[model samples]
Target: MSEVPEAEVVFVVADLAGYTALTEAHGSKQAASVVTRYVELAQEALEPGTRLVERAGDELLIVADDAARALRVAARLRDAVEREPLFPTVRVGIHAGRALEQDGRYFGTPLNVAARVAAHARGGQILCTEEVRRLAGEPDDVEYRPVGPVRFKNVTDPIVIVEVVAGRRAGEPTAVDPVCRMLVRPETAPARLPFAGRTYHFCSFECARAFAERPEAYAEA
Candidate 1:
């Protein structure tokens, strides 16, 4: 029997947020279908230097050439499902590192980092390693914010995360929340406010009103 060819490929990992609760509520069979669809969508959309490597119920493994495209595709998938509201929110993690493959399958530290990064992602968000950011180039289509360094099991070094903006694709600013003091997703957020001659996104109408009611309460430097 011939062994599968050994080669290296870039790896990506992703997962649905709060899936455990869904699994408990939906049962194994129904949950299986939901996860299956997730992988199917990702598999159908992957571009060059990409392929579906594994789909174990709720987790997805994909190989890609650049991390930016990985992040872009995942964001698009989440945005697509979010528009329906019936679908659950999703999170994505991308890493651009070489992986060792056996029989056309890939594995190694790069794959593990991708999984850990995915675990840290928030709803409709994508997390990327520094290496990935460098390889993927600057992503102007999306805005990014630092999530600080996180510790993951089996990882000796702390991994820094960046949030891939999924709220509005617009290059224009939306609204900023004085309370939260960060740009919120316009669609999910209810209010838009002006600060420093630019609009900022808020998560809800209540936040918008709150900021308007007391501008000094949450003043920034």
Candidate 2:
């Protein structure tokens, strides 16, 4: 048997946040519509060097030639999903490493790490390991916020994670859900609460309740 070739690539795992609630709030048929639309947008967001490896349920696995390309695709997908009315926000995780390539599918620790990284992200957020951040360097339009170290299931050693932000500016007419970290339009958010003399917006009542329970934890500085 021939050995599978190893290639260095960037992996991105993205999924819709609040998908279950979206299903429960809107019914299964409508939920399916959102997923279908999201898949379409995901396909459209792919650039020349990027590939949509596969999609399962609300999550997508995307491979890019480099970390910068991965970030661009992730940001584009997130923005596209959010632009649709009533669509669930997208969260993404990215990592750059070597993976075994065979049968048009990749397999290895990089994939596992990327999936775990994505799992730790909140809606409207993009997280990547330190490897990806170093490879991606620094982009003018993107800001990297350090999330410190995180431990993932079935993975050895802790990986440093950082949040990537490319959409919206400081003065944009948008609010970030304190609990879920979802980016929402202030006018359209389903819930809002006053804390520390400031108003916070949320995509749903669940997140609002969570913030209410622990305002000190999720409150912005």
Candidate 3:
């Protein structure tokens, strides 16, 4: 077989949060149906030059030659899922770098980093590497917040993360406590839990402790 080429591309990974708990709370069949719906929505959101590489369980891996296009598609996918209440919240991550592409599959650092970034994102959030931010340039009507440097497993050095805020409504800043499902102000919340790429506020220390114990249990709640 001919050797596949290596090229610079934007890698994106969007994972469904609370997938395991959703399966347990509902059933495998219902969870499977949600996954199917997510896949369909993803297909609708991808751009012309973008390619869907694979679906790893509740995650979707995609690739695009244009960094800006990839960011746009990722934002679109997030928005699409957000509009559907039946679908679970999804978190997205994007990275731009050179990678090996063989037989329609990608390998190397870019893909690995993208996966790591996605792992850091909170449900309903979009996180991306600084490289992607630079490549994509400044977007209109979209806010980008630096989330500081994050250390990922097996990756040397720290990667800076940027949160993409495109469709969020401004004013009245209130965050939902993952443990108790209560809304609280970040400034007034009695306790806070920082995990992955986001900070979660809680009404009480007890609720924060509960979330710390098993975060995935409250990911969808």
Candidate 4:
């Protein structure tokens, strides 16, 4: 092991949302391709002050010298993944605090918070802790909305989470999954069904099945 030095940095954790479902539905080869493309796109989106710290299967940990810069990078990553046809949606969680860095890896409470926050987010959403929201201040065209406080396992204090909204780019057609509320691109949706003269797009077959079982329940909702 190497020496651990404390550093103040912005941590961002991102992963493909619905990754497990994608693997089970599409098999290992397609899942592996998704991971590979994710890494490529993420690396290309990196700015000067930010660096990719680690990649574990479908998840990525990135560190940035500044909170605002990290938020920009995160948003860019989200957009990149969204525009890619047939790729699963990406979810991101960000936080800023002191963490021990050793041999190009990071460890500490802040990192854990970021990971937990990421897990809380649905696909296509960007979430950040209050610390990050405060540090990043108010960037132009970006808004942070509070999602409420959440307690994480092994974390002593409850973290106030916020959704980082940059707004969706115009002209991209997307629909909401009635069951999970995940945003699905109509062109890439794996499952779609027609009901009541309107078509519903789903991110997965399971959601489609649920909708089929009770069309009125979701159609009205």
TM-score: which candidate is best? 4
Better of 1 and 4 by lDDT: 4
Q: What's the residue-level lDDT of 213 in candidate 1?
A: 82
- Residue 81 deviation, candidate 3, in Å? 0.7
Which structure among the candidates has the greatest lDDT?
4
Summarize candidate 2's per-residue lDDT along 1-221 as a digit string, tens digits.
Answer: 97777999899999988777667545789779888999999999899889998888888999999788889889888878777765677889999899988777889999989989988997778999999999989976888999999999888899999999886533333666766544578988899999989999987887788788888987889
What is each predicted model's overall lDDT from 0 to 1? 0.65, 0.84, 0.81, 0.86
Query: By lDDT, is 1 or 2 better?
Result: 2
Q: In model 2, where is the ten-residue run with the lowest total lDDT?
A: 167-176
TM-score of each: 0.67, 0.79, 0.76, 0.83
- Of the two candidates 2 and 3, the one with more favorable lDDT, higher being better, is 2
For candidate 1, list the clashing residue pairs, or say none: 4-103, 174-200, 175-200, 175-201, 176-200, 176-201, 189-203, 190-204
| Alpha carbon deviation, residue 25, candidate 1 (Å) | 1.5
Clashes of each: 8, 0, 0, 0
Cα RMSD to the true fold for all candidates: 8.5, 4.7, 7.1, 4.0
Tens digits of per-residue lDDT for model 1 on 11-92? 6677776566455544577567777677667776677766777877677787776666676667666655454322355677
